[model samples]
Structure formats: structure tokens, C-alpha cells
Target: MAGDNVDGVSTRESLKSALKEIVDRTASVELSGYRDSAEMSGIPESSSKLAAQETSGISGQSDKELKPSPLSGTEMASTTATSSKSKSKSSTATTQQSITSRVETPSDADVRLSSAISGLQDYFRKPCFVHSRLDDAVDVSSVITAMSPDNFSHLSHSSLVRTATGVRELAKRIGQATIKVNLRSILIVTKARDNSLIRLTRELARWLILTRKVNVYVDAKLRLSKRFDADHLLDPSDHELDSCLRFWTPELTSMMPDLFDLVLTLGGDGTVLYTSWLFQHIVPPILAFSLGSLGFLTNFPFQDYEKTLNRVFDDGINVNLRMRFTCTIYKDGHQTETFEVINEIVIDRGPSPWISMLELYGNGHLLTVVQADGLILSTPTGSTAYSLSAGGSLVHPEIPAISVTPICPHTLSFRPMLLPDSMLLKVCVPRGARNTAWASFDGRHRVELRSNDYVTVTASQYPFPTVTASTMDYIESVSRTLKWNVREQQKPFSEDSDGSTTPVNDDEGADDDQLDDDWDIDDSAFFSSSSSSTALSGFNSAPQSAVTTGSSSPLHRDFLTLDGK
Candidate 1:
């Protein structure tokens, strides 16, 4: 009966029955597509083919020579491992977290290195594309070596090695390493009310990190809450108040001395001054990146963070060692306290209705009784800052001088004077003064000075080091940053030309001749007049009757008359 049924079925019906059976058999196969294996292996089929093509391209290279492409996550990790292995080859490399190989012969190596670096410099001089990757290619060793030792010393060995490696690696990867420097840390400090400046500082920090991968640290307590929530921050929680407390916890507080290499200060000159005051005792170098409206102390531009930072790391820029003032406050003839200032130590009226009385003395000699709103005692470096506003002369940073400027003096006769750096200045508020004065160090940390309180100020033993580009000079920085008489055209006298010297006026020469002639005439007339007077006196004194007799003789009479007159 089964055989008859099979024979009765048409060929198409038989084919359909077989296809249905096949479809039923593949139900498990369709279920397998939904299984974990298919879902878990999420890579597209096209990607495998693309990877295969890439591998095939480098198939001819030896296994050792053919590095895995860093684009792939696994391959990148593998490459990093390989790099770590390469770094471990040297004993000196073990201490260093990053890979750095020292040249066996630095003197000989520098020649070849300098040539390569010079080529890179020429390449960077032109307009070029700027990306994070491009910045890694610039070789700044030549520029570093060419800079002054004082400037170059500011850059650590690690920084120099990293910069050189980044430059060289970039050049090898691409055609050139684009120069994009960054100021890594910017500290913005303002009063509790300065929200606008705080916002600007945050914006600057965001721009730097996004465009240049620079790190920014804000030290202002008022903006700490907002900065902790900033979106661009990688580890917002890391900078939380709790984290900061944890960092300075009992265990780590002792180690705080060794934690930070440098500190960066943002905001105005006041912020920099405040930061310097806080760290002066610790004595770490500061990189002050200005974010304020007026930046006399801050030489760095907010926009050129990348270039500035790169110059710091790569070329070993110079640092101006700014002098600081150390003040010792005395109360009732006892040493009460000591403070340091980067700018000026200002003694002013503290909420008093009347002007403060300040008796100033320089090296034990009484300078003057300064009756004014305040007095500014500043280092040469601070001359352009608060002192300048107080009618002080702008002294160069390199000059060893101190500026004593009176602020809003009651008398017009009071003018600023530059004193020798070696002198110790004593400022006192005498007994029964109309109003008491207050002393502040760098616009921070104020101390009240009652009647009979004395404040003594002198140059500090230590100096603050400030890093700058290799091409940066103190005078040039003042001119460019401060916009102090930056004239484009040179005066004729200033021009470098081989020309005839200006002639002296004939009147001047005649005056000199007349002076000589007058001296000679005076000397001759003096001797002649003395001799004639003696002779006439003797002739007239011979006798009153002799004088009347000499009147008949012209020579004797004239001589007698000249002697009498």
C-alpha cells in the first residue's frame, strides 16, 4: 500500500515533500544563528576581509620587522608590550617609566643629531597642519643645545628625552612633526566673587585639553565645585573635595613635598603672586600662564599653550630668576612673624578713615616720613607691577635694585626711588599715629600694624625661576607682553648703518675755547693785578705828598688810581 501511495504521488508533489523535510531539518540551524556564538562574534564579515588584505600587504616583511598595526585594540596592546620590552633593555631605562636611550657619546652624537634637528626646524618654520599626532614629530634638540644653559637647565632630562623621542618618532611616522606647544597646568585664583574670570579660566582649560592634550589644575577654592563637574575633565571625581582631602590625608601629607614637580598659576599677576607666596617656602619653580585681563607677571599667552609647553619640554627654554622680598614683622620689639613676596609688600590703611603714617628707613638712615594711603616696597621684577601704578620706575628684572614707591601721597614732592638691592628697609608706624597701617605680601596674607609696630623688608635668599621659549628675552618679553613702547620703525640713530657721525655744533667748540681762554685770562689778570696793586700801594704809601707828585707822571698816577680803586 506504501509503495502504491509513493507511485500515485506526482513528481512535483514528491519534490515539495522532500523540500519541506529539508526545511524542517534546518530549523535548528536558524536557531543556531540566534545562539550566543553568532551574537558574541559581532565583527562584520567585511572587516575580516579588510584585515586579511592589510595583513597580506605586509606578508612579505619578516615577522620581526612587520609590526602589528596599532589601529587594532589587541595589536596596540601587543605593540605597547613590545615597546615596554624594548625599554627594559637598559638599566637606566628601568627607573624611567617611559622609553629613553642615552647616547653613548653625547658630544659626537650631537653633531649628527643637530643636523637632523636643524632640518626639522626648517620644516617647522613653514605653515603646517597641526594635530596631536603631528606635534609628536618635532625634534627640538638643536634648538635646545643652542639656548643658554640657564634657560635649558629649567627642563628636566625626562622632559627633554620625551620631547626628542616624540619629535623623532613623529618624523619617522609622518614627513614632519608639527609644532604645537601647550601649557599643561593653569591655576586660576580669584576672590570668592570673581565668577567671570573663573568661567574664562575653565574655558581656557577646556580648549587646551581638547586641542592640545594639556592638563590644567585650578587652585581656587570658590570654583572648585564647578570645576569638579566640568564635562571635559577625565576624572572629575579625582579632583573632588574628598579626593583632595584624601590626597592630603595623614599618610600622604608628609609626602606632599615630593609629589609635584612644578606648579602652574593662572589668572592675573595677583594670582601668580599669591601662588608664589604659598610655594616660596617649598621653593618649586612655577609656570604662570596668564588668564587675566592684564598680565604683567604672566608672560604666556592663553591661546599659545601648546607652543609654549612644547618649547618648555623640547627646546629647554630660559627662565628668569625673579627676586623675592622677605619681610619680618616686629611687635613691641619682639619678632612676631615672617613672610615672603614675589611682587611688593604693600603697607596701606586698613579700613581706616585717615591716611596711614609710615616712617621709612633705608639701612639705618631715616628715608622719610611717608604720609599717604600706602607705601610699596618692591623688587626690580615687581617694578612694572603694583609699583608702576604707584608711580615707580620700570626696572628691568635682571637689575639688582629695589623700588620704593608711595601710593597716593598727600604731598606731590614724594616720588619713587630705586634703592640698592643690598639695603634693608624698615617701615614703622609711630606711636599716636592718626590711623593704623596693614602690611600684605603680594596682595595676600595681610597683617595689621598697630602703633609702634615695625615691618622690616629685605631681598630673600632664594629666587623664583620662570621658564620661557629659547628666543624669549627679558626686554623682548616686556616689549611684546606688556606692549611697552613696541615701535615698528627704528629711529635713524638706532638704525644699523655705516654712516658719518653727527657733527658737534661750532658754538659748543667755541664755548669750550672760551672757557679755556677765560681760565687763562683770569689767571693772568690775577697775577698782574696782584703785582700792579702791590707796586701802586707801595708808590701811594710812600707819602701823600708823593702821590700828588706821582699824579704828574701818567704811569705812576694810573697805577696809584687803579690800586686805590
Candidate 2:
């Protein structure tokens, strides 16, 4: 390895020397163009001839050194003709012709320059593509020259054209802006400690790296796991796997928000929730596989990962920005800890055998005194989760609303209420409260709220973007998992000749099938497209920083936006 490094250093040094020489020569040519153009503007024949002779000398030297000279044949001929014309006549026409020649053969000079660069590249046996990149970087002037003054903007070459009154016409032409990105790096969050999952991870990693040319990242634990890299799991000849595999820890994800293009979850909804946990600030678009049971969030089937991934990679995906709550716990009037809660935050009495007296305030105004067992503050995405079980409404994921459900209110009249996402609500354990309240963020991170300590809950700017199988995947999940509005099939009846109605006999297994088919139709009747239209356009995070205060950390700067525009 040391010898290899030494040889690499030598090659790089040689390449650098060659590049420096070319740069010096190009600089001399550019300088000659500017200085000679000014000098030959109105100078006599002898002066123009001197400039031409100097240019010819540079070209002649290039011809001897490199096969492809920087100056093309047309350039050389034009130089010679200009010199001859200058020697014969120092008239306005000759000067005009000389300037014209320079402009006319610029394209040829560029071609020759590229050809020369290519020839230089051939001399090196480097494995990387850096040599070819230097060709373009070194020839930046060529690009500026190509964009002539006449071409201000090329509408004909533009992707978006406003034909109709709306942007949909352009959307059809350009496709979804969210899906227009190059899906390069992917972080796969696999279910931990499962050999079968490990095998699937390896299989997916191989396909992503080899087939899609993507950088696959798994949890750091899988990098050297005995089961993950077991001999039986990998082929004996697959020595290249070690180098290709990549691992990402929680710390890295927190630091680098744009680390992954997309995150794939290989488990139930818990794994999907875990992904939300991984990136506290900015989260990439998540594509979850339903490997475990009760796949509310993980709708996509694991068996069809290839098809799903192909569609996501090639076409695009319909992403629903699930609303989240940014719960900030404040102790002694100073910010203690902040968490991005996907599901809900439970503020309940933990081990304390007393009623949890909590004060709820919205927008700095006292809303109510939660004289209950506890309060469940949840986003619309968590409505079907713990919030629903607590008698909260099953709000859709796209709804910009928060569910405030009392776990078990002291008063029977106290019911679950839906609040606008814009409301900045604060739940505080009163200093004179009976017992201290415990807070659980998304079913994890159990924290205690003491007297005078308050927790602020608001609609998070950073939302969890989950890829859906369809635009109505959330509805389908509700119907399938929660069995929403599901009931026994009504028997079909027909009027007889005697005016008596009788039940129509049908196959035993057919009623369930008919009812299943009817549910989709019934659902379409209730929920219209406008009702569930995405409030935010799509995922836009890690690009710009969010609203930051004095206490905000650098890692938590990016405020995830889903502006449809």
C-alpha cells in the first residue's frame, strides 16, 4: 500500500507539471489576443506581422510537442493570412477582416483545445476521472465564449413553458419537481438483530450499489455484525462487498441533514417511526417496507421492493408530508431539550398515584386546566395511533391539525379537541400541582415535567415525508389496518311479483368480496381530492436553514419546508 501511494504521488506530480505547462501556454495565448488585438487595432503592417509571427511560433511549438495543437488549421491559416494582409496593406478593411477571423474560428480553437486535453489524458494511466474533469475546468473561457452576446436566453431549450393558465401544464411537461432529483445516496434502516433482515439488507445493498449505482448506508451496527457478514450470507468471491458497504450512525445523520436522498425502512411502522427518530431536524424522503405485521406507515410490500424502488428512482413518488410536533421542554425558564415527535407526546402521571394537574395554554392564553390522568398532544399523523385509542378523531396525515386528547379526563364532558397546527400550545405542570407529570415523545424519550417547568408544543416546520403507494395510501391504511367504517355486508333484495321483498341468494365467500369492493367506492364518495390535498408541496429540507434562536444548535438549523410551489 505504501509503494502504491508513492507511485500515485509520482503520477500526480507528473500530471500537475503537465497541467501547469498547458495553463502557462494558454495564459500566454490569451494575453497575446488581448494585447495584440489592441496593438494591431490601428498599427502599421510591420506591427501586425510581428504579432502574427509570435502567434505562429506558439502554434509551431505546440505542433512539435503535442500531436493536437491548441490552434486548429483554420486558426493557423487565419493567423498567417492576417500577417500577410498586414504586411501588404494596413487599411481599415484588413483590420476588420483580421478581427472577423478571430471571432469566426473560436469554435475551432475550442475543439482543438479539447482534443489537446484528451491527448494529454491518454498519456496518463490514472483510474479516476479527474484528468477528464481538468479538461473542462481548465477551459472555462471556452464556455464564456460559446455563450455569445446575442443569446440572452434560450426559451426554445427551456423545460417549462407557460401554455395554459395554470402551472399543471408545465408540471406535465417538467414532471414533479420533488422527483426530479437524482436519487443517489440512500440510508437503509433495517430491523436490528434479525439474520433474515441482515440477509435482505445485503441483498438490497448489492442491488443498490451494483445496479442503481447508489451509495447505500445502513445502521453502523451492521458494518461489522457477525451475522451480517457471515460466510454463508455472502459468496466466497465477494471480497469487494466490504469496501462497497457504508454505515451511518445517528450522530452523523443529525450532523449532516442531507446525507441521504431517501431512507428505506425494513420493518413495521415502528421502524418507520425510528427513522423519524434518527433525523431529529431534517429527514429525507422515507420509503418504508411492510416487513412486520400491522404496517400502518409501512404500506409498501417488501416483496415488491424492486418495483417500488425502480418507480421511485425512475419516475417519482407521491409523498404525504405527515405533520409532526416540535416539543421543546423548558426547565427553570431555559430550554432543556427539544424533540421532533412524529406520532404524539404523552404527558401523563408516571408512578405518581395522584391526578396530573396540567395547564394548557394556546398562543399565550390559558385554554384549560387539564384535570385528567394525562394529556396526549399529537399531530394528525398520530390520530390513528395512540390519539385514536384515547377517543381522538382519526384525522388524515395531510391534515394540518393537532389532536389534544385527554387520556382520561377527570370530567366526562372534557372531550378530545382538534386544534389548528398553527397554534403554539404550552402544557405546563403547575408549580402547585398535585403530582409531577411525565412526558413521552413519540412513545420514547420519557422526560419528567416538574413544577414551574413547561413544555411548548407547536406544528414542526420539519415534517416526516413518507412515500405512499398511491395518493390515497393513508385512507387505504386506515381501511385495512383500523378497519375504518367497516361493517357487515347488507343483503341485496328484489321485489317479487306478489310485491314481497326477498333476500337474493349469493355465494358465501362473495359477500365479503363484494363488500370489500364497495368500500373503495364508498370511500371515494366521502373523501374528495380537495379534502386531502397536500398542504405542503413536497419535501424541501437540508437546503436552507430554518428559523433559529440563540439556543438552536447547528445541526438543527435546517427547517424542513414542503412548499408545493
RMSD of each: 27.5, 26.0
TM-score per model over all chains: 0.46, 0.58
Off by over 4 Å in 2: 1-178, 230-243, 505-565
After superposing candidate 1 on the true structure, give the runs of residues whose Cα lies further than 4 Å from its correct spot.
1-258, 350-356, 410-413, 470-483, 486-565
lDDT of each: 0.55, 0.66
Task: Give the deviation of candidate 2 from the true structure as CA RMSD.
Answer: 26.0
Q: Give the C-alpha miss distance for residue 349 in model 1, angstroms.
A: 4.0
lDDT of candidate 1 over 1-565, digit per residue (tens): 0111221222222222222322222222332211111122232333323323333333433445333221233333444556667766655445343322222223322233234323323322322112212223343445556455776678889877886797566434432212222233333334234665656555555554555453344442433356434443445554532222101111111112112334556566666666665554433445667666666667776667667655655653344556788899999899998886778899999899898788999999988999999999998878877898778998877666889999999997998888888999999998979988999987778999988999999987656656544334556657766788866663332211333223233345544744532222123322343578786667667765544544576657777876885
